[model samples]
Target: MEAGDIATWVGVLITLGISVATYVQSRRQARIADEANIASQEQVEAAQRRAVAVEDSLAEALRLLAERGLTEAPPTPAMSGGPGAVRWNLERRGKHSYLLRNVGTATATGVHVDRNRATPIVRNMPENATVRPGESLQFLMAPTFGNPLPGEVWVVWEGQPEAISVPLP
Candidate 1:
């Protein structure tokens, strides 16, 4: 062949080789992308399985609590003995009996209700009582003919500077 023809043939061969290399590179990229997609799908499936396991565990715990006749969960204790650490409330258990509960984390010592004009006669009131967390003291309140049940009572305890008025429920 002539020199010009040989140069033209060489140019055609180089173009063909570049085209084949490009095709191969594109195929490799496509394969890598497909593999990454598959790995992402597997990760999503694993996360879904973990979520289902956690949900099943929570359901089992609730079922156990129900079987034991504990329908209500107890309150979580406070983290520290700060402003909202110590709290008290009065709950009526019966017609004459009441429960003074310490619903706080800190201990309440020397707990007593201050008597007022509208206060009823309280029986079994403990003297300088010590109530721990989640504990309660039972007392009987008898209302006379003139004085009915008080709307509220003043509660005092150790570590508390002043008496707190708790409304009756």
Candidate 2:
């Protein structure tokens, strides 16, 4: 091959290398952008979930303040697990009590899990003790474990799906 021909071939190889490098860089940037979009979508979904939870809590608070006569006395200190998932919070308003009985015709309930997450309270509740839908035996309010919880407290109660907190305090 002639010297001029060799020089021309070298120039062509350099241009091809530059083109391949540019393509690789562009592909890498595209992948990075895609990953960023996915992360942003997940964050949005999490925010939406938190917003819903807050809305439900607000609705419950409203219900507590609106009702007057329905809730004569406070209910039992509802027990639950985990950090955020609380069935009831009577820490500030003092200890609470409950005497739940089935109103429905032989509907199964009281099947609860133990501390180790086992089904220990399988049908723990007694038979139909005749607590009507609008009737409760003795949803009393007692003191806490040791202390008389004073001051303005922030107690949160989360009931079942079909249940709403009555006589909001």
Candidate 3:
């Protein structure tokens, strides 16, 4: 070939080599993007499966609670009084709130907290409150101008006739 023709051929070869390199690089990048997309899809599917499992577990727990509530019977008046008398306890729920719980096997009706001797005066005491076994009544107790909060208080309920001393925990 002539000298000018040889130079032109070299330039054409260089251009062809660059085009092939760009095509190969672009194909490699496309393969990497496809792999990344597939991995992302798999992660999303796994997350969806986990969410479904959690939802199913919560539904099963709610179903069991509903079934238990349906099967249980109410306590009779005869079950209370005498040996299975209504027991009471006081718990400090927060800085100003207290929970009066019936820890006995029987239900306590017309429950009242005697704030006469207590240091912190009990406020918002429900009038004629009824507390069933394992149930509690929450009330607010705050410090007055005179005395500090005590560790124990007197609790009274209907049919008991006497006020019982309940201690705080």
lDDT for model 3? 0.72
Candidate 1 residue-wise lDDT at 33: 64
Q: Model 2: runs farther than 4 Å from truth?
A: 68-169
Q: What is the C-alpha lDDT of each candidate?
A: 0.72, 0.39, 0.72
RMSD of each: 28.6, 21.1, 23.9
lDDT of 2 by residue, 1-169 (tens): 9999999999999999999999999999999968966775665456446645755775686577557545543332222232322232111122343333333332122212121221222122122222223222222333344544222222112233332222223
Which residue pairs overlap in candidate 1's backbone? Answer: none
Q: What does candidate 3 score on TM?
A: 0.50
- What TM-score, over all chains together, does every model reach? 0.49, 0.40, 0.50
Better of 1 and 2 by TM-score: 1
| Reference-based lDDT, residue 140, model 2 | 30
After the best TM-score superposition of candidate 1, give how far the Cα of residue 129 lies from its true spot, in angstroms: 0.8
